[model samples]
Target: MEVTPLINYINRIVTLTPEEEIILSEYVVYRQYLKDQYILQQGDVCKHANFIVKGCAKTFHADNNGQEHIIMFSVEDWWASDMGSFITQTPADYNVQCIENTELIQFNHETIEELYAKIPKLERCFRQITERALVSSLKRIVRNFSKTAKERYIIFKENYPEIEQRIPQYMLASYLGISKEFLSKIKSQLAKETKS
Candidate 1:
């Protein structure tokens, strides 16, 4: 896979000189996960940070009752990993699973550290990414706290127009913190409003 998006994302974060880009590219490894595979199982250290090239994946946690709640979804051009596991090299409490067969550009934690040492500008790039990720997570927390289920659904659709159709309703319900039946009811209400 051509990792153009990952390169572009890095370039946006820091103007990577040609030599820097080449050095960074040397560390990237391309991998594919089949549908339904767990890219990062709960309790395993997430050693690699993945940049999505194709397909969809989700980060989720399972409750005591064995129910899963999705924390995040990643599609093309997005990155997904267990934050705690990647940083600490500790076992993660969450799982990252491929919803569809996925192609990803992956770089090991060691490789990232090497990049930081060799190209310090790349460290600035990751720092910016971390800040943005934190901000986005906070915004999602606020949205979950303040928005109604229907409203959250609308917002989700607005924000991820491309992935909305590809994602399953049950998974969407988990992400929205609503029951699947509730999501069905909301869809029916939307249909009723449309017919009138």
Candidate 2:
């Protein structure tokens, strides 16, 4: 029932009245998930939009060969959901799994609709959130095509310094679209360059 973090996150994008805050608290359901737990799985309809109050999660798609291609990572104060599925209420193409013990404030389709009806500002806040996510995804796609592996690795480290220490190296490598060995080499090369 802790909702301060959720309230604070929303306030950053749009100011909410005290009454609206209370309404939001009522609409959201707080949930905890253990590490490696799947909040969502491929082929299942995403029932809720989850806001991370704490911990980390990875959103990825499993290929036919069963290899997971990471789409993104979410940590404290971030949001995690299969947007396509959540909005459309269709089968999800990606899986959202917790990388650490996670606390989330979730809003289901009905509750969110009701909340939006009750507080019109919330709809605008969510729209902005979705737009930002879309922009970030587009940027990642551009980087993957235009940048070298080492360049992408450096950018990842720069953007997600907190995430680097939390997840395994292999997962990080997967996110960078490179092999673990290659990432190690890049790190070693960078280390040598820094030492010289």
Residue-pair clashes per prediction, in order, are 0, 0
Task: List candidate 2 segments past 4 Å from native.
Answer: none
User: Model 1, residue 129: displacement in angstroms?
Assistant: 1.2
Clashing pairs in 1: none
> Candidate 1 residues 74-182, lDDT tens each?
9988888998799999998899999999999998997788878999987888888889899999999999999899999889888889887888989999999999999
TM-score of 1: 0.95
User: TM-scores of the models, in the given order?
Assistant: 0.95, 0.98
Number of the top-ranking candidate, with TM-score as the measure: 2
Clashing pairs for model 2 are none
- Per-candidate local distance difference test: 0.90, 0.95
